[model samples]
Target chain A: MDNSEDTERIASVLNGDISSFEPLIAKYQPRVFATVRRYARREDEIEDIVQEIFIKAFRKLATFRGEAPFEHWLMRLAVRTCYDFLRRHQRNRETNLSQLTDAQNEWLERFHVSDTADSGDAVAARELVELLLDKLSPSSKMVITLMEIEGKSVKEIAEIMGWTLSLVKVRAFRSRAQMRKHLAQLLKECPVTVEPIKTS
Target chain B: MNTDKLWNKLVDEVRKTPSGHSVPHDFEKRIMDRLNSTDAHAKSGDSSKIRSLDLLWSNLVNLARQATPNDRVPFAFEKRIMACIDVPLEVVDGLTLWSRAT
Candidate 1:
């Protein structure tokens, strides 16, 4: 929807017409959920974070001027909310290096043998990466999630996160270092066999 | 750290993690329910305040509206304010006068 429609709906919501808020939620839910999915995975957890985002957005609706499209404004809120969630819960949810599943082990083993491997599709890759990423601190997880998983450039991530460019770069560097540490540990657990993929 | 081939492979794969398009079937309903509950809470709070104001005013009608709350408040406070209500308009300031009347 356009800016004026958003303004009208926002006015209605603020004016105590509660149901008018529904359209705004419906229109933005997919994008907000999709963006939030990158930060969270559990069905219930995702719903909570998504719900919180709307709650926050509603509470701060008065601050939203018509300067930007409502989606753009809401997205900034979504990203910030997700980041806040990680900061709050990351320490409590810390896990040791988890045992890889048989499927994961099989993928890793096959991957170990393939030189310059492009064999595994996206889903398997994402699963393996997410498993390792769980061990990183929340800030590192966010840096890597945006940089690699969401395919956001550092500058873009800075804009989305409201951080300086240098901060994004530094976090990216630390995130990469942390990921490499995880990979090194994983490789040690699962070694390569004698026959490796032939390189060009 | 070495730029290992594995890291690149993994990064490329994760970058392919798809963004979803499907929304929950009841997404809008969930938000509306939350908003409705909050609206109800605010409305209830306002109604309760109005109820309190009505109660305060009804007590005042027996005491007469001319009694300013600042008038010599007796020790019983409410009873004193009420007692002061019936006193002569000239007896506005003295708790001593209300004590004598009692």
Candidate 2:
């Protein structure tokens, strides 16, 4: 269904008609899960986080004054939920960064750079990307995942992260720089393609 | 490379990064099941008192508007109210008895 229809349906659900909410869940679940998976470690945890986000959204539906698009609001909620999950998990104990071996690091480094490479190069690149992402700070990784990978605009990201426009831009820029530096180092070590593409 | 172009390339690369893990096939169903159960639980627990109060307040306001002047008295009208209140029931009964005797 279109956004307008979804809004109307959500409004109906908020007014006590429960069945109207199913379409909304079906429509936005993939995006929500994708956002959650960027930060969450376990598959079960990702599912739980997504469920929590949707449940929160449904419960707080009354507070949604339509000031923003429904999808934008939902995205904001999803990002916040992921952030909360990360923070909660971090408080429990230490993360084992030393567990990454040379082979795993190489695989992850390749994954990030080759993710955008030709279809033949995708698999190897993906492995590298995953590894590199694992090394990043959750905040940095999240910023990149939402603004870069998800293609959400700066304004939308600011809303999602509860950050100022300038802050979002700054974080995005920093995150991109970090990823580039890491990928560049990986590229230097492995030298995936000898000849660099000429840029004007 | 110019920072702008470099940034774009980095973003492009990140976007292309494949999540090796596939989302579970029943992901939506699981989410919906949880949402439905939670929603049902919430509705069952929520009180209808607010709705009832709103209806009651609305009716009261409408009734106040329809009420005659006699139904609404200002605090300054106490003298007139006291004068009316002074008639004892025995006096009233005795006056009625005298009127009947006459």
| Reference-based TM-score of each model | 0.59, 0.51
Stretches of model 1 off by over 4 angstroms after superposition: A2-4, A96-98, A115-120, A191-200, B1-102
For B1-102, candidate 2 gives per-residue lDDT tens digits of: 999999878766765677864455576699999999999877744433233223322222233223211222223333322233333336457778999999
Where is the poorest 10-residue window by lDDT in model 2 chain B?
Answer: B65-74
Look at candidate 1 and tell me the lDDT of residue B59: 25
Task: Candidate 1: give the clashing pairs.
Answer: none
lDDT of 1 by residue, A78-194 (tens): 988988988888867754444666666665555545423343333444556666667788788888777765668989889888899999999988877677666556655654342
**Winning model by TM-score:** 1
Residue B70 lDDT, candidate 2, scale 0-100: 21
lDDT of 2 at A111: 39
Using Cα atoms, each model's DockQ against the true complex is 0.01, 0.01
